[model samples]
Target: MSKGKFSSGVDLPLPVNAPGVTKQERAYQAIRDAILNGLLQASDRLPSTRVLSQRWGIARGTVESVFERLQLEGYITRKVGSGSLVSAVIPDSYLKAVTDTRTGEPDRNESVEIEETPVRQEGRYRAQVGVPFVARLASPLLIAPAEWAAHLQRAMAAMKPEQMCDVEPQGAWVLRDQIAQYLRKHRGIDCRAEQLLITNGIRHSIDLVARCVLKPGDDVCVEDPGYPAVHRIFEKAGANLLYAPIDNEGIDLHGISDSAECRLAYVTPAHQSPLGVIMSATRRLELLDWAQRQNAWIIEDDYDSEFNYQSAPLPALKSIDSMKRVVYCGSFNQALFSNLRLGYILAPPELHHRILALWHTIGRSVGVSEQLGLAEFMRGPAFLRHLRRSRQEYQTLRDIVLDTLMAEAPGRYRISGEHAGFHLILWLSPDQDEDALVREAERLGLMLQPLRNSCREIDLPPAFVLGFAALTRAQARNSARQLARLLH
Candidate 1:
């Protein structure tokens, strides 16, 4: 029999762990004791067999055998991508008979009794926007569950105990290094790992930059009718925002005067939010030149540059920025699952330390496990393979939605923008009451958002940003038909 502590730091004494017991029996008793004593609560994840074996000074095969026995006994469950989770269903008798080894009584397990979880229904909506609909977003074919699981386990197994202790505010060095290489190959951004700071998401990245750069009441140029969330983040940072409207080419430089004199400007150059237009290369150079002349910073929010079906994605704005004034931001939220909330910011070399300092001051750090997992995911063929498959699938779905709308709506609507991105804008005649249409759609159990929701410029035309990434081809057809009937 061997003795060790549970991952949760609880100690347990079991008959199987006593002298003369076989190693397998001792392993079984240790797990059972951990479960009943609340050291491993229901739904809690168990360490991988490799991690367990290393920790216990035992063979990996023995740990695997123990896991197999636990699975057969219904003590744990395993999912393909996500590893082992403790079983929620504990035999009622075990809870009642659980022993308090310290007290030589049966009371400890009672304290950690698991509660039943309730089932809830997903909200029913039609034509949802801004939210990533999990069912419609990434296809499983692109993201192989078994492969993801294997990569995740390997990443976990590769971690040293000390590596998991505390994450750097700049993020895991390995993930940042991979991101640097990924950006160079994919987005044409020339940067090193030192310039990249890992963040919870784009919002956090923006906040960190604002904290390090903006003083209270400083002017910041933001695209009008852009990502509303970015506006909110800058507002919270105490910026006096200049709403610069965007045209078909991209952000309207004419809209901002020479005297506008802003410290920073935010632009979605890759694919403009809500409008889906790629910022032209000429305009890209102009923006960079303006930033250099004004001695200002540019925050390029490269949102959804991965799913371009029309043309090859333009090199990132930062690639053309010889002035070192661009702070490039990208998020895995839209590319991966939204809940993951992993993002990165590539700061200028001059400001990198300041941004890192601010990041550390705020104590913002992503979980080491996910960072390591993503590092491994990107290091292999998985990430790029998934990106290719998803881009192809999304283009198919986009075509379906566009075709259905054209056939059904006829003269009532026109696609204002559709060259790239997961969503596009349907421009209705200015006379059409956008609010009334939205209300009627809601009454019909379809959710529709008016263009006004994303705009700060009041005179913009009436349109609806239609998100098609989450809709299946059949759903798109049905939704279009339903809207056509309502319109007629």
Candidate 2:
């Protein structure tokens, strides 16, 4: 795909990403920009699709489509072997002379159409989420009941004419206030609405934090058996992710190099994912001290912390941050349903404005209807009732699974991390192979997520992450017996 004699002068610029614009749109704009700015003169040769695609890191088909579009719009012409050449006359009449909408004065290169889809998606996207709550445990109801819909209707109906055009990047103040109150009353996190920035979910919050706070090559300490998506997020953000292993105390701080100049630590202190070990009080302070000493930040993901069976869950890691090094994130997706698509970050006061600015820049906020409806709901008893209902329901499901497993499996396995969260750990005997057990479970039509699947490198004792939420009593019993047979 060499450009022959035209390779030297051909300068195809890369796409500049605009919020809500697709990569194809950006690439189109890039080529058009190259023409309008005189970087690509009339009659100048353009590179082959392969060359342009390789240079732009876009798919070759995408580059070809852009070329086709350019040709369609009278911008480029292609010959059999000479490749693409800029048209003798580029379309500049409208592009060079865009009129200002307010004053009717000639504007310089400002008007371009980029199709943007709705950023905030809300509503009962599914009847149930996570554990298939409706199908297995409760009546087949959506995450939101009829009451929620009525509230949403009222919310939308109540919007004033001017309010329809409002944009709240930090999200509606009412929702933030509700979240603040909820955190204070339920999670023991003392925070104000002013310090909160609404997000899509914890994943989105983590991504923003990494992009905003971490620079390329900055070392970030993450839990080894942690959320796989988050590991990819950090890597994508150009941060060097160091998978710090977890122990009964939580993430083994000693394993993390004290002198590596780690810029951040990501931990689920309340309920360690997959393993479900609450960070001991001593370890929490030690982690805080480590962050303070290293001048690093901590991302406390309070996922599934809402459900604790053993005792009252500890306050979030941010609850006792004397040095304000922790950025607390929580989501209603797990608390309510996965499709809620709403979460918030309690950014440290120092980082609040930065995170908020980034939030606004990305236009990642829930829609007015969802936010307003949720605000109203959280302001009432229904939200608390929902929590209570879910807690009770999960506890029932937990009991069923426990009874069935205890009866069926007996002494073949040990369970941990069952005190909180929907999943529990089934620690297999050392001689049992995790992969073999997983494959056997698959063969038996039972879902068995190996604990090793969550681990990055360091080996953990053989175990299975037995998630029982999506199972009914019968299904649970059957699966338990199947697992018992496999283990025995």
Tens-digit lDDT string for candidate 1 (125-233): 2224323222223332345667767877999999988777855657888999999988886676767786688898887888888888898898899887787778887
- Per candidate, the number of residue pairs that clash is 0, 0
lDDT of 2 by residue, 268-379 (tens): 9988876888775446666777876788899999988778775445567676565568899899877776667888888765676667667767775577778888887887
Whole-model lDDT, model 2: 0.71
Q: Report every candidate's CA lDDT.
A: 0.71, 0.71
Candidate 2: TM-score?
Answer: 0.70
- Against the true structure, what is each candidate's TM-score? 0.70, 0.70
List the pairs of residues colliding in candidate 1: none
